[model samples]
Each structure stands twice: as structure tokens, then as C-alpha cells.
Target: MADIERHDYDVIVIGAGGAGLRAAIEARSRGLRTAVVCKSLFGKAHTVMAEGGIAASMGNVNSRDNWQVHYRDTMRGGKFLNNWRMAELHAKEAPQRVWELETYGALFDRTPEGKISQRNFGGHEYPRLAHVGDRTGLELIRTLQQKIVSLQQEDHAEHGDYEARLRVYPECTVTELLLDEGRIAGAFAYWRENGRFLRLEAPTVVLATGGIGKSFKVTSNSWEYTGDGHALALRAGANLIDMEFVQFHPTGMVYPPSVKGILVTESVRGDGGVLRDAEGRRFMFDYVPEVFKGSYADSEQEADGWYSDPDNNRRPPELLPRDEVARAINSEVKEGRGSPHGGVYLDVASRLPAEEIARRLPSMHHQFKELADVDITAESMEVGPTCHYVMGGVEVDPDTAASGVAGLFAAGEAAGGMHGSNRLGGNSLGDLLVFGKRAGAGAAEYVAGLGARPEVSQADVEAAEQRALRPFEESGSAAAQHPYALHGELQQVMNELVGIIRRGEEMSSALDELAELKDRAGHMAVFEGNRQFNPAWHLTLDVANMLLVSECVARAALRRTESRGGHTRDDHPGMDATWRRRQLVCEHRDGAVTVTERTHPPMRRDLLELFDITELRKYFTADELGEVTAEL
Candidate 1:
């Protein structure tokens, strides 16, 4: 490691998405030498692709909306499987984080009273998202990038060069995390542009990488999301929780094969769009479960009226949590009520004027017009489910965002247990912001407390280097298998078998397929021998990560027999009391995955008091309910 090209930093933040950028900001602010390393360009992380807004209890639209209500909504959205403390912190700290972003040059859509505008989304009792129309994520990334540049400018003026403290290494892929005595020492990465391997030695590493969406064929995620951080954390000896809870966003573009599976932001429905079958029937009312009783409208008229007067009527059934809506759409298509493209119809044209639709959802309007040749303002657009996010990730502490491994921290989508089995729409942005700063601050505090830096041995470096160069060795031979072909196979397997709805036999078959793919992935090779920006070489590493992650997803899904938020089993259609109280944790040991069930600890007495007896009875066993009530 010392002989190779090596650099030193106090902290190295991996995955420059919203959480990574935010973490880098916090670490730099604390005067720690920080480096932000990302697989893509600084501004192109999945955070920029987020079309929906940021969830925060700003209370601008509904004064009664507070952290307490937001907390309850989030807990309900996750079906009470969420970590109550994380929900509490996210709800309480989100508003301040959003407001802080505004100071860093973020502009939000303003309300009539000149406050940050709020909008309604599924599972929220009140309008809670503070956003900039439908392009909130773009604005968020722009603001964070601008802040990074501003910091660099300040550092240059104070010192001689910009690299003295904070620097960004874009187009770099971290292949392996270097460890010293089972703790994080640094990470080994390659420059995506030149294929040159490099190492960064740091005492602390923060993982802000996003989800495993691209493992499935129909996904809103970009090519960068192959679960690198998830796999990296596991290999670094950190546990991954709730690996089966993959989120299929309800409204992905379902028409025009070229534009298939692209996300249609939830802002459309928030602005008064309706979901209908081929018969123009609003069908979500039939799918509401007893747990969400009295939370949504029962009639079309009541639902429509509630948009204008929310206090008087319940929310529309079309605005149910993503899981409920996704399942209903699946049922509608299965029942032969689907639209022309095997999707349900989403009609904003009938609800809002052409100009209003264009202004509120400019990206979606243009996306459909340019890609699908459909005018969202004039006709209903066809939409169905697509793999959008994974609620599961590396398990971390709520307050500090620390994984069990020392000097290793995870935040944003990379860290698990915030959303539980399902995530509420717009909660993604909020989770990244709240935990990103915490992870960064935690890393800084951790580095300060360390007595000495961990040592990196040459044996670890040489082994990693040999593994990375395997593509070049296998490229020229006739036995070579193209990495792209292997990637396509992985995506197809994830989509067809372990997709939206699950069955025991199908997932078991997927696990078997994944095992073979893992062996084949090791034999993958690049087309060109050269390392400079070789797409095939990149896929070699990506396919391995995707294969490992796919195994975790499939194995965990098979183990969870009961139907819960994202890990739904067709055979077990209802939530079972036995499985509801536990989560499956995955670890890579002895070249095989080892999974174990861990019971959720009891929530603090204060947070438990937020739920009523009725809600408690739904999730807990009689003995558990008795303990909760006794605490109350």
C-alpha cells in the first residue's frame, strides 16, 4: 500500500449523493481534512434524479402539522417496523435541515404567506414536503454542489491550494475497503476515466451510497446503483438489515418501450391527478387495509374535495402509501382492468389546467412529451410499478450513524433501519439530510478520539490489486464472457423472480440462479485490454456487487414467509404475528451468506406513548402488547 500511489486524508466520504455531499460539508466544517469520492460526477448522484420533494414538518400548508404527526405518519408508513428513535430525529430535525439548505442558496416554491411551500404525499396526514415544484432533488443537489464550491473557494483564500482540506474525486469507484485489525483504515478505488487504481488512507470512512435498484430490470435508478456500498459494508464486517424490503414505486412510465420504468414523480397525484382503471374507475379504495382505516376517502367526490379542503375530508385513496397503491395497480392489471399498456391510467389532465400542469411538473411534462409522445396535460398517462429504492442497507446507530465496525459510518440510503419495511414518499431526501450530517459529524468526533491511525499492510493492497486486474487477464482469451451480457442476465433474474410480488418457489429458484451467476461473474472479462474508460471493465466490478446484493435480497425474501410492506409473499398474503417482530440480517462469512433473525428492541417509553392502544394491538403479540401497555 505504501509503495503504490497513495494519499492521506482524515476522513474519506464515499458516494457523493445528497448524503455524501452533506456529510462532506459537515466534516469540512469541523476542520477535518475530507475527500468526497463518488462513482459518477459530483452532481450526478441519484439524489439529483430524485423527482419528488423533501419531507419535513414545515407546517407552512397545515399549521397543525408538527414533528409528532410526521413521526406517527412515518411509523405507520413503515407498518411500525421502523426504528422509533430514527423516525423521531428525522421528523424533528428535517425542518431545520431544509431551512439550512435554503441558507446555502436553495430556493423553494413559496406559499401565499411567503413561507417554504408544502405538498401532500402518501401516508402523510398533512402536507409535509418542502419542495421546489417537482424538481426539488435537482435543486437540492445544485445547492449542495454550490456549497462545496464555496467551501473550496474559502479554503483557497485562507490557504494556498484547494486540496488542503476538502477535495472531490469524481469518476472514481471504490472497489475494496482496506482494514487494519478488522477496522476501517481506508478504501481502494479506481479512476473510472483512466482505469488506474488508487488508495486513500483515512482513519474514518462514511458510506453514503444509495440503493440496489438497478439489480432489477425495471428500475428508476441509474447504472451506478449496483449496491456497491451495501456489499462494501458487508465485506467490511458490518451487518445489513431488512435486505428483502425493496421498494417498487407505484407510478413508473408504463408506455413506450424506450421510456419504460422511468419514474413519474408523485407530485402529479399531489397536484390532483387520479389513478383509474381502463373503465375510468378510481380503484384504490378497494385495496385499503384495516390498519389504515379512517385515514383515506371512501368516495370519489370526497377524495376530490379533500384536495381543496383537507381538514374537512380524508385524503384520497389514490394517495395511499406506495405499497398499497403498487399492490392495487398490480391487482387492477391482473383483474383485466389495466390500461392499453398493462398499466393503470393517471389523469392529471382532467384535474388541472394545461398551464398548471406544465408549471408544477415541468420535468414530467417534457419527459412524457419527448420520450412517450403523450401530452400529460391533455390525456391520462399509463403507469405501473418499477423498482425504485431499497429500504434495507447497512445497519447503523440512530444518533451517531455508526456501523458496528469501528471508524466505519453509514448514512442516507446506504444505512438501514430508518424506513423499516417500507418508505413513505419524499422520506428519502429527508433521511439523507438528517443522517448525512450526523454520520459526518460522527466521523469527525471519532477521528478526534482515536489515539493513533490504523496501519495498512502491503499484503492487503497486493491482494486487492490482483483481483482488480483479473479483467485484463481474461479479456483476450476465447473463453472470455462479456460483462454486459452477465449484467443483463442479473437484472432479468431480479425483475422476473424476486420482483414486486414474491413466492417461495420463485425466490428459491432465484437464489440458485444467483449462486451460478456469482461463479460466472468471477470469470467475466472486458472486450478491450486497455484500461482507459473501459465500460466492460467497470461492469466486471459492478456485476459482482450486484450479484452479491441479489443473493442477499433473494435469500432474505425467501426467509420472510409473511407478507409485509415490501417483502410480500403470495403464499403468505397476510402479515403474520411471528415474523412481524423480527428482521433478517445478512452477513458474508466464509464466502457464503449467513442470515440470522434479530428481534426489535422495545421503543423508549416516551416514543411508545405516541401510539394508541388500537395501533399497538395491530403490530404486537398479546404478551408484547401487555408490556407496551404496562409501559404506558
Candidate 2:
């Protein structure tokens, strides 16, 4: 035992993003001693990178907007594969969550009448996103960070102590979930700065770690999002649902290889940007699917007209959901309609006024000007799809946000079922707020009812410590595989084989390649002796998680032989009828990953009635519709 330090808390929240902050805040309100552990500095967690806004049907811009409409739009955007209960709760609670942030001192852009401004986003039926220009997420993090400090002030006042009841462990990475028998007891973690081991003994654990985007070669996610929470939950015997659905956002800067996968916020289109091909043709008009046919404009004239008139004209095709736009961009590039940099052109110059573009999307303007040396007000910028988010993660109960394992709660991008097969724009931020609070409240309730504090086994702690040091020991071996090489190989494998387009043969080949990569990762090593801020050593651990998540993604993609939401099969083509009723879930079996299928949970009677029966026929079968109606 390498002198591992141990601490105790009522709850240990892994990850310090928007979800973790909200969950910790709620946990503290229940009088629980909580600890937050993250791989980065507190507020810098990926939530700060969110640019667009938070989706909430406040109806500020459109009076007809409400939760029911939001719910319908979410279901439709997800291809009706969403957990209706989760969607219902998310749609119903998001508005209040947004309003609650204001109470925490989050300022939003104001309308002419002085209410929080709402903006249009892809797949939303109305202007329903509560925003702060293009930096809504910055306001969110600043507010949550301040609220956490205020809570600590109150706690210290009550206890007459310097440190509050809640604690934060920054620049730490959790390696294992310490389980007592079958339930979560604590977690084994290590600091990134010095590689010292830590044992967090807590009865309840909340996983709010974000997503798996870092597994791809080109991604919008940061280094921390290597599917840590997903891999940790799987190792702890929790099921990962819908692992195949990866969201590839349509607009990423394609030039300047150094900044290739940087996110181009969808706010560009929501604020009236257009997607044009090499020949100056607006290409999205030819790609709208039947599900969103009437909602998008059919011609350039109609698309231009829709910017000013809200009720009569339909939305421009540029504002279609990300899945549609990503695929359209992929197809256009493949057919040689791409820009000089192998991406489509995003033209705000042809749509919005220069002053309006700079006022609304200063980040996008600055990003292009600083990175690519292209003035967004003067010319169209090259953009392409980049791996952005994963819609799959630990499956949780709709109401409680509890995983299948007791005392294990998940929310935000770490948890699945809310978005189903795909997530619409702005829903991710709302998810962080809505479910973050619920997971906190749920974990607090579960803790109050527990018999006693669970104990962490000494043997497990020793094993974790030993494993953490294995890379340093193996660094001198002849067969020592460089962690960076292995990591790059993993990224290349995933991006080339199992990327945006999938096929049966390609996915099958990816499985065999992934197995070999997993073997190499098991023997991965780093450079001699440096432990402080050693990125190479850190990648050795992160690659393990990426390999596990990559296998799950490729396996699930192989199994689901249809196109729906974020998952599209090149061979099988369109959405298959039989596949529509099933949700692909993954588990770490005896020694390998095993995938299983389960029937999609049916929606409640009242919620089903909110959608038009004619539109219901798109997803459900006649018999399924009858079963749903019979319940009423």
C-alpha cells in the first residue's frame, strides 16, 4: 500500500461539470457531507465550452410554446425512441431549472419587453432556448460556481469551520468504484498533478462525467471526456444503454489543422447562417427527411423569407436537427461539392447583417478570425461534422436518476434514456440542470434510508494502488508500448472504421481491430519516471476507458442494423421496423463486453395523447398504437 490517503463523505460526486455542481448543490441542501471530484479545475469542466444556450419552453418569444410541444419535438427529434417519462420530466422541469439559475444570478440576454430572451435552435418547434448571446454556458457555470461558494459560506457559518460540509477534489481521475459486495461503497482515484492515490469512502456516488467524444480523431470534447464515467459504471456492473448513437455536430472548423475539431456553435444557424456548397448552392434544401418535411423550407426564396416572418414561412433547412445536417454535409463532401478545405461553406455573410452576426455570435466570429484568419462578416467559413456528444451512457430510472445498482446515481451526459437515439440542440444543458438536481435529491433520499456507512476493503485499495503503478514498472520492458501511439491508434481506428457512416463489414472489422488495441493498451507504458502533470501516463489510463467505450459503440452499431436518429447503417439503409422497438444495452460480462436488447419502455397514456395520431404512425406500429390507446 503506497500510503494512499483516505477520506469519508456522505456522497461522492464524480465529475464537476454542470451536472456535478447542480447535484452537489442539491445534496448539500439535504444536509449531506458531499465531495466533488473532477479531472480539471472546477468551473473549466466541459460545460463552459457550451456556446449556444439552454432549452426551456418559457414561451417568452412565442406564447404557443409549452412543455407539451417541447416534449413532442424532443420525441420527434429522437425518432420516438426516447424514454417518454424522462422526456416529459425534462421538458416539464427545464423551464423552472432555467428560472432557478436566474435566482442564482445567471443573467440572460433580455428582450425588448425585459424578459429573458429566447432563441431558435435546431429541432425546437419555437424560439425556446434561454440564452446569453452565444455564451449561455459561461453564465451557467459562473452562476453555479457562485452558488456553490454561497452554500459553502452558509455551511461554514453553521459549523464554525474553515472548510465547508462540501469538498472539491480538482485534477483527479477516478480509476475504480469500490463496491461493498454489490453496491457502491466508495471510489479509488488519483491526482493528476502528482499521481498520488486517494480513497473516497461514501455510501452514495453520483456519476456526472460528460461523454465519449475524445475517442474519435476529430472531436469537440476535451481530454477529460474519454468515457470515464461510462467505463467506470460498466466495470461496476451498470448497464450502458444506446451506446451506438454518437452525435456529430455539422459545423466544425475544417481548416487550420491545429484547431480542426473545434465546435462551431449551432447558434450560427439559429441566428440565420446558411450552408452553401462549392457552387454557391444551398444544399440542405435537398436533404430534409420526411419526418421534418413541412417544418423546413423547400426553396431558397422560402428559406430567406422565413427569417423575417415567423408564423407563415417554414424554418430554413440550415436549422434542421444535427443528424440531418451532419449527414448532408458528409454526402455533399463525398460528392465533391465540398469547399477548398474539404467541408461545406457556412455563410452568415449571405444571411445576417455583419453587425447582427458580430453582436449575436461574437465567439464564432472571434474563433474564425483568430484561428483561420477568415473574417466571418466578409466570407463563408469552411465547416464539417465533428464528433460532439454521445447519447448513450448509464441507464437510470426516470424519476430518481438511479442506475440499476443501488447507491449509484447518474445524470447529465453520463446518464442515458432522456435523449433516446439522438439529442436535439440545447437539450444537453437542460439535461445537466434538470437531472443533475434530481440525482442529488435522489441520492440524498437514498442515503437517509441506508442502514449504515459502507466500508472499503483494504485488499481492493491495495490492488487499485498496484494497478496505478504498473505503467511505471513496465516502462523499461522491451515490449513496452507507447501510450501516445496506442491512444492515436485507438482514435484512428474509431474515426476511420466506426465513424459517422457505418456498415456491417466495417463494424465487424473494427471489433477485431479494437480487440488487438485493447491487448496493446493492457501493456501500455509511459516515459521514464515523471509523475507530475505527466500527460503520457494519464493517457495510459484514459486509453483503457476509450477502448472499452469504443468496443461498446462498435458492437452496438453492428447489432442495430437500421438508420434512426444519430445511428445510420450504410448497408441496412433506413430505419427497420423491428429495430424500432428495441434499445441496445451493453454490459461487462464475465471477462468481456456483452450486448443485449430490451423492448423500449412505453409512454404513459396522457403523454401519448399529446401527439397527433397521424404523426404517431411514423414510429409505432398499428398494434403498438392500439396497446397505447387501450391503456387510456
lDDT of 2 at 511: 97
Q: Per-residue lDDT of 1-632 in model 2, one digit per residue for the tens?
A: 56788899988999998999999999998999999999999888999889999999999988899999999889888988888889999999999999999999999999999999999899888998999988888889999989988888887798875346888899999999999988889999999999888999998999999999989999998888999999999999999999999999999989988899999999989988899999998889899998777888898888878767768438889888899999999999999999988899998887778898899998888988998898999899899999999999999998999999889999999999899888999999999999999999999999999997778999988888888778888888888899888888889989988999999999999999999988877788876667788888898889999999999999999999899888888998787656777999999988599999999967777888997776777778777888664544
Clashing pairs in 1: none
What's model 2's overall lDDT? 0.90
**All-Cα superposition RMSD per candidate:** 1.3, 1.4
Go through the candidates in order and give each one's C-alpha lDDT. Answer: 0.90, 0.90
TM per candidate: 0.98, 0.98
